[model samples]
Target: MKLRELAHSRTGDKGNTLNVSVICHDARHYEHLRREVTAERVKAFLGDVVRGAVERYELPCIGAFNFVLCEALGGGVTRSLALDAHGKSLSSALMDLDIAAPD
Candidate 1:
């Protein structure tokens, strides 16, 4: 399943860092997300844009995961020439990551 079917996301950025939060629609699905949504997968999904590393923090109580993408903004909005340098749509893009459909 795509992440959007089970979760939703929000994003923020500071300089070259990007933070994307994935929140589960149901608490029961948190475990599945924890298993499936790895830093590796996120890094791979975001691809070349993420120049540094991917770090994932789990929030069990909130049934959410926060992904920190280092050096991902093309050098931040002020420095980045790329359109949408702020990475505002990154959360929406992340929802497209493929995962096993919940049974």
Candidate 2:
């Protein structure tokens, strides 16, 4: 019941902030994600990497959830010495998030 089975994600970054948009394959699953894919949940999932705050914006019209992660890029892509400074793996990693599968 991983979220990936129901949705896909896109990610981008601007300095230390990163944004990940989770788009549901079908609009019907919006409510399910709204309940399970919470900001707190995402923040907890990402853990200490997010130093500031996590905010979620809903796009019901498009059946997508946009998660804005603050201070997540370590020290900005240019400065962070981490091998994956852009945090591209975050999207794939987040796909492992468990969600309730429809019956």
Candidate 3:
């Protein structure tokens, strides 16, 4: 199953950093997402787009996970030449990540 089936995401950008938050539709599925979506996994999934470290912050209270991606914006909104420098589409792209169905 895709992550999108279980959660939705929001994105924010600061300079070359990108922040993505994944919030589960059902709180019960939080554990499953937590297990499947790791910083390493996210970095691998995003590939070359991310040039630095990936940090994962668990928000168990809200059944969410926040990922901080460094050097992902090509530079920064004002400095990047990329069309989607703000990385709004990044959250939507992340939703496509594949994960095992909740047990």
Best prediction by lDDT: 3
Instruction: Tell me how many clashing residue pairs each candidate has.
Output: 3, 0, 0
How accurate locally, in lDDT, is each candidate?
0.92, 0.91, 0.95
TM-score of each: 0.95, 0.95, 0.98
Cα lDDT tens digits, model 3, 1-103, are 9999999999999999999999999999999999999999999999999999999999999999999999999999999999999998888999999999999
Cα-based RMSD of the predictions, in order?
A: 0.9, 1.0, 0.5
Across 19-59, the per-residue lDDT of candidate 1 in tens digits comes to 99999999999999998999999999989988999999999
- Which is the leading candidate under TM-score? 3
Model 2 agreement with the true structure over 1-103: per-residue lDDT tens digits: 9999999999999999999999999989999999999999999988888888999999999999999999998899999987889988888888899888865
Q: What is the lDDT of residue 74 in candidate 1?
A: 93
| Regions more than 4 Å wrong, model 1 | none
Pairs in steric clash, model 1: 1-99, 1-100, 1-101
